[model samples]
Target: MSYLDTSDPQRPATAASDTNTAVTSHAPSDHIEMSEVVKKQSNGHGSVNVEEAQAQFHALARRLTRQSTQHNDKSGGDIEKQETFDLLEYLRTTSGKQDEAGFAKKHVGVTFENLRVTGVGGVKICERLMKCHDEFFLSPYYLAKSLVGGPSAAPKAILHSFNGAVHPGEMVLVLGRPGAGCSSFLKTITNQRGSFLSVDGDVRYAGFDAQEFGKRYAGQAAYNMEDDIHYPLLSVAQTLQFALKLKSPGRLLPEQTRAELNDEVLSTLLSMLNIAHTRNTVVGNEFVRGVSGGERKRVSIAEMMVSDIIMNNLLAANTCHQASRAVVCSWDNSTRGLDASTALDYAKSLRIMTDIFKLTTFVSLYQAGEGIYDQFDKVLLIDEGRQVYFGPAKEARAYMLSLGFRNMPRQTTADYLTGCTDPNERAFADGRSAADVPSTPDQLAQAFQQSKYWSRLVAERQTMQAEWQGEGDDPSGTKGQFLQANKEEKRKHVSRKDPHTVSFFGMVKTLVWRQWLLQIQDTVSHLRNVLKPSLIISL
Candidate 1:
């Protein structure tokens, strides 16, 4: 519903003019005179209800036009076609300038041809081709449509066509409920095939197809799913080393180079996610001694960052220049805001890095946190597979208030979003005044039950209990069975003779014989030496 009208720049102006003409023509003389006075005063003082005036004018014109004509079908269709063509042209032109040489190369010899044939011939040829290689011709969009039952079931619908181009570095938020197909939309953009749609829209990166976009831009865009950290059975240094090996390219680096890369990755990750203290700690199962929950999250993020860095470095080395752009998407469930020192340091470091690398980052926030809006250019609000709002974060509160929802006094964008999902409970949590509170306990209970907080907690507990019981029962049984088997095996083993006393007597007798042999050898050698000396003196 909240669509960007990027098409037809003259449409609004034409509508406004016609509406103004109709309104002025129909207004009473006294009312017209008063309107003139107000307009003149407003203009003089630089104050005007321009938007309302334009709307009123357009509405009046539309009413008059509806009464005057049945329909101009042919003209309307022609105008629409022209508009589409013009919009497409604008897209091509804008996209062309961004990467002129690339665009030229891609479109150089591409052409659409219409093959003429008598009905059945063309149909038969298409059928044969379809049967021959369906996989080759099938696209993600077509697959999604088939799975979802129809094109209408597909998540994306053109709300408003735009004439101007959407520039790079511009953030577009696609907000929707859990099952509203937002994830599908994203998947579509990534060219991931499945039963559901993730992202459904035309996306070009630097004048390349979606596949090419993935190759060129995917490395820059990091999509962090909401999953607990996976700690490998290794030390901190070993873990990073293995990660580097997996993510980094080429033969293993020299020891010094490896160490430097590791240190750099570790430091950047620590600064980015604000978890420097846990740099040396192991990240494994908590029951077996591992990092804290927050630290684990940071470690996972660090792994991702290291991957991106390696990707960028590889690309830079190949291209003979530095990679200058990056994007990251993180899904977090933590409601607590970052520490002040960490937040400040991150902001400063992010600015410096962005400047150094010319990075354009897009982070999607699904958790409750403060200052996230201030860091991004735009915020998109989606509810139930529809765009509720899309614009500046500062305007969000007013927009919600206009929708008959009360804004929390100290709530962040995430909190407000959560509240939107469950207004009554959020209101209660905020502790509304006595007069403003719901009248009955039933109402409050219903609100609380509907809150995401309660639902997520229940889900998490159920998962934990299931995992614990399943793992605990099997391990306990295995230990008991092993112990029983060991006892039985020991009892069945034959008893050995007591040989210690016999071995001790044998060792004493061997030692006495060796001492007697040594004394006789020493005396014989001394007598031989004395005989040799006496013979030499007689000669």
Candidate 2:
């Protein structure tokens, strides 16, 4: 018989701190059983003090202990097996029950036509020399060169004419070689265009134009960078708690307060990612020793998801019928630090979230296995900033094959699609020569323009644009509904037109609280820094 020991669900175990280490005597897929018990115990105790909550929790734990002991005695031999709790499963089952406001029901999709991104490249030494007209010796020569034909920085096209749509409940895998603009494409779609020199395209989120989406529902779109960044001194729990606090929505679920809801969501996130045990551990960097890189990556993901949920609370406040999708996320090689199995698991987890939340997601991966590749609904292949292909994920291989590209033995579908970007790496099909197929990036781009995939994308975009135009009365579109609901959820002081549920002062207070929490968490580190100047002077 197996038992899940949730003796202290609030405080995660610190016994196994290593990210790579598996939970002892528990299968990875095993579901924890404390959610029901916790719900029952806390039913009427929502406003209970910390001490009272702890007392009730301990009582529940003891009851579970007695039950396990009784089962062990009946089975004889005094042996028992414990199962690791599955937080994602608990959330999945309890999601509908807790937030009848349709937190998981809202959906958001993204569509872009003729999407192009351009950026200025770094200056070379030669270009720098051309700017040395005021320098000591070569003033005359540099001046002459500057007057004649000085090197000037030109905008390099990072992404050109990329057209695609990712609807609610669908995940698209962006397959491309390094520097193929996969990252740029993601950044552009998420409206992170500040770094780029120019971005020209028609981008809409749930029928809301870029300006409207940015002003009203920007928080609903998130971009998860490849690198993980965190405060090295703060524990995973502290970091996530601060994020939840700052991003806390104006309204609360049924009978729960803001604090209570944050706690519940935080616990669920920690458990969902199976990092509850490492909640107390610091998210260390190169200077400190703490959570492993994989765990840190998971923390980053968990933090992003926390932000997503806050948006959900605002978006799903009303209009459950129109809120099928509300979040659009772009993940840029988010599985970079994980093992193959963990990477696949991460994709599967995203797939689950995409389905359950009705989210529109875009993920870019340089190295993805077949399992991970199959998790996505669509595939967009890029080469040298040009979109070579965009269509269904399963059809990608066949499309590449139709383009006279050969799939090598044991090559994954993701690999095969990415290999199409490299001339030396990709092989030609039988009886196909370089002349018979599209070879260069331009050729591939041109070929894609001629393919049925391009036609389908164009047709889809036209239909969507027509529908959006027909929604002239409701200019904000589907996401506009989310924004309107969010407005209603705002405080009396907050303007109905204001996008944020929290006021300016509220954000400042949350930030100050975070700083205090950080100082308390790492007093030793703070003391060392504070005393370092004095120590140096004494030395």
Candidate 3:
């Protein structure tokens, strides 16, 4: 039984009919099947509710744990998760039943709480001004500064006390400006932290610790990095196939069954992630012009985990295409290097895959287009690793406005909110004294902690947990529907801020012009210096 059952149910049907059934023979093709789940969104888009999705993902993760597993040699927190996930997933599908024979118990989900990560502080202790305009490192100031030794080493706080959750069945878009600690947060959860840091946190799956989660039901969570790396010579198809072979339940399943599973898995993942076109193409590197940047990013996703990559090649070699109840661990910024249109398209593609495959995704992004931003079911906005907002993406605008931030008209939602975090860029309608205005990311985080926004987030999380407890460990969705869950009411608010006068492109142009001017000034100054000596000689 494959950990994730894609063949189960309910392709959302707005394109169906009932009156004249084809040839009037069997049951109506348009009618909702017993296994089909209907989704209704208040905003007209049939997106899942944030709280509801979390409950469902966690439940699915719990349900996917197998009693007895074939592969027992998988080691480490990361691989073990994949080994269990891939094996259970392979068994689930091969066994030929979605729920029966312990196949349904292999869907894995993830949750993390109160995460705080810190590292060594900045590289300098004090300002060392040069005595001369064009000076050498041997200057008195430089020598004195060197004598004092390196700047006082202090612990750098990368991620503040961050509390958030990644629910299944929804795409969580984590956004922040540069150095906002997005990478730090993602790394902490994926257990990818370096040796120079201190981390205090707990990531639980179905109410279990991260290590135990990997042991019992691993591979529910898969991470996609920003940088995409691939072997230049290996064909894309060959790469995915190799991943499949390595992670598939080879020991237990017969060779033919494994082969059939591989074919099915590979075909499904390629089609779902929209990279089917690159199947036979060689995954090339810088030296070899192979796939496009976007495609390369897709390839990185295809390699998240041995179990999950099998799923992506197929996901957490963990569940179905690396997601079912699989937590989509994405520092979604993986698209930052791509153009705006490609980045937007990539987000859309991810949204489609999440909805179609019933997977949960947690993605970190620096930018989100109107189209891309709306596609996400939930948005997690963090500043310096502090939770600014955690709820429906649509309500963020109003929430900020209520806090006295006016949005720039036509400005991308991502920029407007992140801009507010920078006190210099923000001006509250309520007005404030210099002392009253918050400064720095930490101050912004502290302000949020004191505001109604933080209270709201806490209440929302508490409510989600309360409801989960009351309703038991399962979502309202039908049993075996991995990503399907409750359709509870989402908090909604009318956007109160008048649109501002800025645009992302306009800002970019402005910065470009400023840089151009600076460069020209430097070039002219250099010319003047050179010509001054020549002019004196001529005279």
Candidate 4:
């Protein structure tokens, strides 16, 4: 296993507040303090109260002293000099009484902007832009794009387009029908199209444009396709170790460093996925050996996190903050034990950026249970290829019920989907015949064309249409196009061995001779047995 090479030049620096003053004099903390001083003085107009002005002056002086101390610890360079000049200008502008209010506003704005920049830039780079223009964009990293297909194509599409995005510490569920392109989606995202498809697509790693994204995110993502588990080969640690080796070859920590890294990786994974009990347990297999399905999923995740790239990304994403903080505390009255501060600290460490856009196709999400609908943020329900409902999950269910679809208590998502296509349910409630139901893939595709979901998709498509509208309508040279020139063209070749070869006949002759030799030996043994019996009788 070898680590993939990445060309991103900007490596993430240490966390803003973590730098030691002895090492880096102009610490991020000092910059923050200086910015705050500038803000306060500017907010205080020239006619500031004597005591307040004095206090502000002292604070500024203290911050400057700290900055000086830090600067003394390290040799100043062009970057440091530029930073110092910026801070000085900020201080000078804020100290003057005439334009205090204006200076204060500008100081606060600069401070916040710097913080934002630092935060975004400090995270391990995991993705980059592959192709970008005024209207069209494509990430080097592949995302699962689900679409409908016929029975034959449906399975392939489902496997190809059914994928979930896992960013470092978080787990994303790729929910869809058995043939709804989930597996195919995983293969596409991971760039394993050769194994899944006879034809290849233009695949590249995510973050190719931003080299850091490629370097940090290259092998951090893991996929667990729906396959039967084979449990006999290795222990849990061995399995994780193998996966880690594949993810990061040269970059792996030495044995002494591995103990801490392993603990951190295992703990982070267990806490995030809500599975911590099966740490050392063997996964069970029929007449062999393994863990349960859920445990296997956790193990796969663990392997990904052990990689340096994944760990760095996960830390940057603030996923650890969420996992650490969401602890369920139990108090033992006898022992008198409960570390509330520690628990709170753990909780504060985890954070997740909210996803602004969420798209779900009918085939992607099915109804789970009644209250469980609230668990999901967005929902899109599709029947055949058409969108039946799309909105918040709760609202979608309500809309369905209003449209005369009955909701049964304790009904699972699979059951709800089946009910949607049931003939009796439709006829009794809406006076619709079985003809209304979509039977074939073509019909389903047509229905999808008529639905609101189709309309939304069309609208999105039109927005992007202008970018490539005149770039050759025949689609011959488009960079990322998945469609091929012709469907029937053979893209692969195979060679057959000649059946009349002497080598083939020789193998058969050898087997026959061995069988003959065994038969002769058996006959000789039988004769010996008969002779021994006759000799005994004569005696």
Candidate 5:
């Protein structure tokens, strides 16, 4: 873990924002190519002969490559040697590290630019009037499809000219109130495209195009939604075990090592999240008793923080063989319900994990406390559909001051910035009268663009992108920043067979044992539940 030597001469400081945060940029590059041999070996498909699968896979790869070349030529993108990854090499290195270290440095970097997302909001009342006729014998759906009548007329921009870069070992905070386009920004960056949304952007991960990032590099990035979803029937331990077993990189590590790592990760999560007491609690929903909401949010974080080695293996096993993993997690308002102390603890844990694992995390929180706010490496503030600011969290107040906005003395930065654009809070800072001061999100955005900070950022972006192509720009190169410092490390290698060492029978036995233990631990609660129903029936 301490293998990476980060004590080299400090690299040049990135663009300094008003908050003293460094802003860096990256250039867009090529797509990632998965080789036939690597693809075949990545997933454990034991039913077929390896040689035949390899041949078939190679044939398909050649054909696709040929077709892709023609398509790229037509699009005027040059046909260069495609960047390819070695599956065996990656597994040999990645699986062992993930098992022992809880995080495998995937050396992934994310860069997005000029992102614009447009979509129609809910149908207007006048449009709904047309839809009311749908209950009739002949559906308006035919007419709507033929003429492109309904949604086509109402399309509006949700995000316009959004831009940012997130490198590994950094936790970027996306801050905005409801409908300010923070969630949409995360979704567009992560390439979670939907039918309603029309997205235009250049998104790259680890130098590959975003489509490749989302498909082949499945585990490399994850979008954590606001709502935490889980099967309430499964206890915490059972749920975690199921995820680990199903997605574990098969044969990458010895059976014992994999098992040990799994235990270690689960235990660490319990301790970090302060949920050890509820390790066996069923993840109940509104219909049943279970862990509290704040505790459940921690569970969601744990799920996203699973080892990328196994995540990539899970995707590759499904034959979607462009390989990579959840090096980046874009969480949407994940700490909404937690108290200040708990949220601080949760944010601190994320910071620690990000440092150790070299994870690029994007979290959208509305009103974060000072403790949680200070933990962010960078901050992306979205106002309406425009980027209000993107830089260090600390310099935000100064940036605001330069923009004719004021932060009341002793007011927390989060509250001040969140409320600055409100019409009612207009104690103008830049000699403007309250009546003329910027109030709406749009006004704030305009004021920001007019400020000197905007010009500085644009200039900084040019320089940053120019110097980005060289080696060692990736934050992953800074080893032991979190996990180990000044400590040497050893390596372990294993086969595809090693990861698959755990069998179906083993899972069944393990699951049953875990379930029994959960029941035993919560015997009193279970008895009370059972007896309450019986007593009611008797009455």
Candidate 6:
């Protein structure tokens, strides 16, 4: 529950930002091999299984080295060992942190109580009118009339009085049928409250409150929409690199330059996510031939993961903390286009990052498998935006059964919980009548509120807030640690309040370079437009 500990030397001096965390670190040497660092870290940490971790790292290194050798043989030894060594070093960074203590990483947790989301979207267009054209005119007139009469009734509630907490290194699986407000809940937590007309509740990121968090650390905590969005012609590497460069910190780690750190982070992400093979392939749309649909989905995921590394290289230069800022991400059905195996891989990758960096992740998945489900530490079930269950993932099934719902044979727990939201899909236990059991979303929500789980959540939240925020005059917590880390990473010219690690001009320069690269790569496509206009003029 403790948010900040500036006194701890082992703890990374990391701070989260809306757009980025400007953390950097210094090393003894500019060219220190990560192999030596990993060895030192292994010797230092008593709890970690050094042999097991080293075995895994060595296996990956050997494979990558073999591949590099094979490619060099074909290309007449043009590729150097430096690039391969850098990639392995990046791999070691995440691997080394996996066994570290909580204080050793940039850690943060999110807690939300009485979270109510309301929007002006309960009634559908079809339901609003019998005629399409007549509806347009009536809709505006009805609104005007309602305004003239008096203050209107409160908007429909998309999510009501939901309470949950996700600590660092934990993942929460959000389960709900479509239109059950799953996406709304994710949007609210990741500081995308703009999507909803009203959000009434207390949401805290460590010691930072909702308003303060939204204003300061927006991109550090982000929500990834279900669909993928990228330039069709841009290669996967280019797409990811553009994001990495824009969010890059102003400072550099002593062990690596800006380019080396960026390369390391980028290579680590692509390798970990199993998309390294597609790094040079374009993320194509339906009209273009390029990487597979699944690879493109991974590109979206890698793009989001870029936020984690942006701060890693910046904090170590000036402070004792060598860790990057922890990230909290809410993914809305990110498995939309991915197959079952790929989805599981994606979930496992998330779990690894969550463990290594202490990331807080909220994933809303439809028809998630057991493997994928097992990765999450907790689960939240929503019925028409009303939370029916929120507790440990393993306890969700029993909690529902205690309420008289019968689990179908061969049905996965994920599906069974999802079925509880659908009247037609759920079955009641013997001797349990409709009157005896909670059937409607409202009744289910009320039942959950009365359960021991609800009481526990409330108690935990209150205790965490009290501990993190502190009582009495001292008022020591994350705010002080956050401010200090922010100050250290912040550049001289950048405004004190600005969240981005890179300056505006730096971002512009990077983006302009990207645009120029895009045009350079597709000169024929760019020239086509010019030639077409001239041909038309001549005709």
**Total clashing residue pairs per candidate?**
16, 9, 37, 34, 12, 15
> In model 2, what lDDT does residue 188 have?
86
**Candidate 5: which stretches are off by over 4 Å?**
1-104, 124-153, 254-257, 308-325, 434-440, 450-539
Per-candidate TM-score against the hidden true structure: 0.41, 0.73, 0.57, 0.39, 0.63, 0.73
Q: Least lDDT summed over 10 consecutive residues: which range in candidate 3?
A: 485-494
lDDT of 3 by residue, 209-258 (tens): 66654443333455566777666656676677665554453122212365
RMSD for each model, in Å, please? Answer: 33.9, 13.2, 18.8, 25.7, 17.6, 12.2
Q: lDDT of all the models against the reference?
A: 0.36, 0.67, 0.51, 0.30, 0.56, 0.67
Task: Write the number of the candidate with greater lDDT, choosing between 5 and 6.
Answer: 6
1-539 in candidate 5: lDDT tens per residue? 11111222222223211121111211111111123222122222111222332232233233233332323344443322443533334444455554344332354556677878898776654434445455463566666765875454568899877666666667788877688888887777766777445888787665667776555444445788999888676677767776665444433322236576466556655554556677888887787778888777777776765543223322112122222235678889888767655565566556644553456788889878665676687777777788777776767766665555554766566666766655565366545554565566666666666655566665655544544444334433322211121011111232222222245566576677767855675676678889999999999
Q: Model 1: per-residue lDDT, tens digit, 368-485?
A: 2343333343454544333444444445555444333455656665457545645354443233343544323233323334433334434543543344345443322322322222
All candidates in order of lDDT, best leading: 6, 2, 5, 3, 1, 4
The sequence of per-residue lDDT tens digits that candidate 6 reaches over residues 11-103 is 122222111111121111222222322221222211222223323333333433334332334443423333444333543464334223211
CA shift at 80, candidate 5, in angstroms? 51
lDDT of 5 at 301: 70
